[model samples]
Target: MHNFEEATSAFAKASDAISLKVNFPRTKHSAMGLKPYLTKTVWVLSVISLLTDIASEMLYPVMPLYLKSIGFSVVLIGILEGVAEAVAGLSKGYFGKFSDHSGRRAPFIRLGYSLSALSKPMMAMMVYPLWIFFARTIDRLGKGIRTGARDALLSDEATHATKGRVFGFHRSMDTAGAAIGPLLALWYLYAHPGAYRPLFLLAFIPGVLAILLSLSLKDRQPKPSGKRQLPALFSFLHYWKDSPPAYRKLLTGLLLFTLCNSSDVFLLLKVKQAGLTDTAMIGIYIFYNLVYALAAYPLGILADRLGVRKVFTGGLLIFAVVYAGMTVDGGGAWYGLLFFLYGLYAAATEGISKAWISNITDKADTATAIGTYTGFQSICTMLASSLAGWIWYRQGANTVFAVTTAGVMGVWIYFLVVLIPEQQKSPGQGG
Candidate 1:
């Protein structure tokens, strides 16, 4: 086996060549423009994510069902998910900052993938649901650490003009894995009949594959600058003060947008309210993921071609409309349409937003910028999810949907008025 240093250097040289070839001027883009973006690095990272998501999702859908089978209460399961997500969200920023301070993205990527990969066999060893809880938290902790740093590396590798398209393609690949995972689980259960432990053990293969692939990723280091290092990681005060104006503005817009949005569980609850069978609900959920996977690259291309601003604005508007549609007793067909639209909204926002962030920040701070933005968005989204749940319980679904729609609409207008113009003037697109 090659030494790690040699493997890293080889990966970096190959990535650099691919980036240059594919990320040529958007004006010179061809019908085969995607050929360039089909870089070895991006594809490798996407495959890693694809494998990781497959491993995670195979277990994810079955987790609650498995817990209930093992006599764990719904309350405990809910607590586990809540706590795990909170830990992941809180840790993202710190890890991103670490990647920046250390000037290496690959090490953090390796460590994160290793933690999550270790989580699989741990789940297989579970005799109690509590053990599963620890396993799940460990997996989520890996997600928190790797996500920002991974995106930063992606941003670094992508050209400024094609950032949206590149991120969009990655999202497409990730969603493809999400779509495949459940089917694999379902097939496994059908073939082996109640062999949950075997299925859990099988998850380890993909997780390990993900980790091994991640080990070969190139780490981009910050150029030699003699800026004073912070005395302590917790002493982020100076860093925050020194953040670019563009990053701050972008963060404000993101916080406002995310504050209006909440967890997808609320959408699922609406499906339940509509009296859909559990099987039908699963079908719809899978269909939604498929739509998300299929639409991401095309929409990302549209973002690159027409401007991410235009596409993002349309997405926000659609979000408001979808939530508003849910406020009423729309038939099952309408609900299906809303879910499809939700997928489109995801395609519109997820990658484009990251590309947008890359556009606004200095390239050196890519990891820190992505981490801070993601960490802030995760915290606010947590609050938004809780608030939506509370309002739905206290009032009604309509009341909850109405409030969310109003908030989304408000943000849409705010974006049109303040953010979009800046984006048009910014480097991501034309003046």
Candidate 2:
């Protein structure tokens, strides 16, 4: 019995040592600085996003104008945006769970991007608002399919220590594409007036490239353990019940914060409200993208060092201040500042939130947790947008801003009392 016990202990130690050797230096430690930046998986996925967003954003910035030109009412536009976003959010959780169950990520990603690519030319050919609605819905569906799967793949490939950097780099690349997409659209619009169709068709080229790039991605299947074999479609409410109270508290705080975050359309509307021309509004959006692209990675690195919860809380506070400023200031330059600050907020929270959720959940359920978090946030965003729209139509812009300000204050109080203590107890819970 002693001999058997000794042998078992020896084998366990040997297995651990082997794993350490194989996975050690998981992130390269090259002298070239940038060479050690991200795992090959993250780089490939980032490139895919870069191409995909370039295609998607080509139409996105001017989508409202396109809808208006086609005679869609503002109410319809709001409904379309809200529904599309809600669908995307809702799908992420289910599709993510599906991927987890099937033990495949790459195929889902391919399907998603392919669907999005197909939507581009269809959008160009739309003769009616309904066609635009279908195109946008399909496009957002594609986004939903890939978002969780791709993030799960990123998590699978990156070392825990470098997860923040990998996610941040991916976001930076994604936002860079966003910045470039609008510029390309602007150039196309300039060179050929009333050639939106041609630009939309042109966007399909990058979408094809994104799909092709996705083909090269390798799927990382989770191990076939007993824990993983259980029913995959678990309720997030039940899942949270077993989680540390800190995680639940953090999520509650996040829900509060997002309720005020609302949609970017409101920001564009605010720009117009501040007296910017349509063209200048697009230009301001371009400016926002540029700032978002530049700041995403650095802010991610900062989050890694200073902690995600702190960075996220600070981001919420910044957003409150920006909304307050937008309320009081009507100058065109103030619009620019608002957009720029909004970009900063995006840089701070987008990737960091995903990283935080991953930290809170088990590895097997990472995708599910991501989906749940996003879904919760999206539901809040939908409600906020609805309220904002009502405020705009009835009370006015001041009411909208005031309501947003109140929402942010609610977020502040929730986090200070609940999330902060939870985070303190689990210092390194989420990466």
Candidate 3:
């Protein structure tokens, strides 16, 4: 086990490696002197995300294997994941709303990271199914608690013009951690085969580092709002009705698209059906993450240069092509190309959507607006996965792929016809 001092030292080293020292240039976007997009807060928050993801991903690949070893059936494992995800998804909105009402981001950020860090060792110490479920829920719950506030924190750091760049850079760093985490797990498991318990404890190192970094953030008190009324647990749902027309329009398109976007597991399963080796599948997934990490920042910059709506619509086009490609029979090489394109699709949409939303909504409502969308987004994702599974099991993979492709086209049309026009008519809503 790493001692506190060793963990702190590792955190310092990582901070030094990932830290950005930006020399902002005066541009049309910032004619009144440069607004530092890559602020210290942005980089610090991103580093915290990178470290936490590393910790979580290190355990993710081995989770099922470990669960089975501890006597959980396939059905039980599925139930565990479903429930854990539901908890995480629902809490994102509640906590996000709570953070906004309280006018504090740092406390939620700190508590969320701390809970996740503490959950690591708890997993290693227990083998009971209930205990494992409890620990897993804690891990995911931490994600829900922090997501809105963290993104809002990122949003607060940059202006409308720089939102895409800020978010894109953060996504790049976060995905880089995802890539690094699984490799580290593979390395450890290679050296000490079947030593999964100790690996859980080992993941704690990076998690602790994340928590320590989160603690350093100082909260800025937001201006007091007129209404301090406490929201219901599911009160974020009400935000949809009260939010701006542009926000509602954008969210409708986003949610409609999300309803068609299923889990990435289906993609892996597709390649598996093509007779690729396990090693090849893992390598391909890592390659996809690397592509996403590399492309996110550049695509974000492109979105800033062009328009966020344009780039986001372009991503949907890419999605349509990828799914259409999947319908054709492809071997490993062709599948590789599709996955690479898929990564680009993710990079273009994920951060860019949030940037788009932040630009159009009131700053005071940043967390609430994002929280509601993400909250419903999570539910839509669950439904999409279930619907896709049924279609794949009944109709077949190619049929599901075709269906998804058609859905993407419909969404693309809706964006061009409806959402874009709505944004254009609204004052100061262009991003």
Candidate 4:
């Protein structure tokens, strides 16, 4: 018995030594000196996202179809989409703040990913439309929890000079997953007609894989004392109150722009209205994601060379043009062009906008600023989506497009006349 106990002790010590070796933090020099393509943390997280997005997009492209199949109305679809987005936005801010307070990102990340993974399989069991709604909400809840923590981890891992490149690369990988996901769903749909449950079950596999990959990530060390404390839940009120007039004006301009930018479901509906079949719509969407994935990194590089605001404004202008084109009588080809340009607009602004926000804020409060910005934008989107639905129901799709175009034009005028001059004088001018 004594010999057996000794053997068990020896095995425990051996296991401890192996864990220590495997979990040792990489040297700062090693992390810093990594090749752009071979950065360990970035690559690991990218793979995590790649797998998770594959799961996410599988459901994303088919969600509306499922709703329609179950006899949901357009208004109901808009509400669901808006609620999902709002929940995600609100949760992004809250979970980001929670992560900052905890001084640990990994646990939240693991929990979030695990929750999302579980939610996907549960989608298969959803019978009623309300059950599906609950499933979607749970899925979005996981997204909200993961997004902020993952982004904060990315920022912590990157050097300032290469932040654009790092984030751009990550975004590209994410969109590439999006590009593949829809195609995968299309194939599955074709293979087994009306078998969305099997697809949902298949989604669980990738999500689980992503969570397993996340377990390998090393958490950031806690920041030293003398840093600013995290603010309270209502901190945004104080932040806006204390911010400079220029900052206030910029936020206002952003809000004005977002108020017009409704849910992308409207665009999908437009494709349907324009006489394309469901399979054709998915094919067009796949093309749009291809454009988005291909263009995002190049646009980020351009933002680094030119300026984020300039690239962002150009995107807004493109949006204005696209909306105007949508207002005009157009065929299926025009809808395709509109979707492609929409992808371009997304590539121009998505990561760059966050980068710009990071540049403007204090380093200690980086997560807070990002959360606040996202929260504000989400509120605007919620309003815009609801209004778009109403406008489409009452006035017409053309009128909704016309109104959105006008809002985009207004943003352009504001940026040109007001924000540009103030931006030039700011400490971190240009990209």
TM-scores, all models, native as reference: 0.86, 0.83, 0.90, 0.82
The best-first sequence of candidates by TM-score reads 3, 1, 2, 4
Tens digit of per-residue lDDT, candidate 2, span 1-431: 45654553454235335423343332233223322335566778999999998998888767777777778888898789888897888777777776666677898899999999999999878668788889888988898888778888887755444555567778989999998998898888888877667777999999999888888887766444554443343454355666656567777777877777777778788788777898899888889988888777767656655677777778777788888877775777878888889888888878877777666655666666676777677788888777787888999887788888888878777777763431223444342
For each candidate in the order shown, give its overall lDDT on alpha carbons. 0.77, 0.75, 0.85, 0.74
Alpha carbon deviation, residue 424, candidate 3 (Å): 9.8
Could you tell me how far off, in angstroms, the CA of residue 20 lies in candidate 2 after the best superposition? Answer: 30
Error of 2 at 427 (Å): 14
Ten contiguous residues minimizing lDDT sum, candidate 3: 15-24
lDDT of 2: 0.75
Ranking by lDDT: 3, 1, 2, 4
Candidate 1 residue-wise lDDT at 233: 44
The residue pairs in collision within model 4 are none
Best by TM-score: 3
Q: Which residues of candidate 4, in runs, are more than 4 Å off?
A: 1-38, 65-82, 126-133, 223-237, 242-247, 420-431
Q: Write the per-residue lDDT of candidate 1 for residues 290-341, one digit (tens) a residue.
A: 9988788777777776787888889898888889989878667888998899
lDDT of 3 by residue, 1-431 (tens): 23644554354334323432333342465455454566778878989988988998898789889989999999999899899889988999898888888898998899999999999999999898889999989988998898888888998887777788789989988998888898999899899998899999999999999998998887767556586777789888788888888888999999999999999889888899888987789888889989999888778776776789888999999999999998888788999999999999999999999998888887777888888788888889999999999999999999999999999999999998894431334565433
Off by over 4 Å in 1: 1-35, 128-130, 192-194, 220-238, 420-431
Model 2, position 332: C-alpha lDDT score: 73
Give one digit per residue, the lDDT tens place, for model 4 in 1-431: 45654553454235334423445443343356443422567778878888888898988877767778777888888677678787888777777777766677788788888888888888778567688678878887888777767777776655444455456667878888998888888888889878777888999999989989989877767543565565476555455776556556777888888898998878878878888898778778888888888777667655654567788889999899889988776777888898899888988877776666555554444565566667778888888988998999999999999999998998888888885331324454322
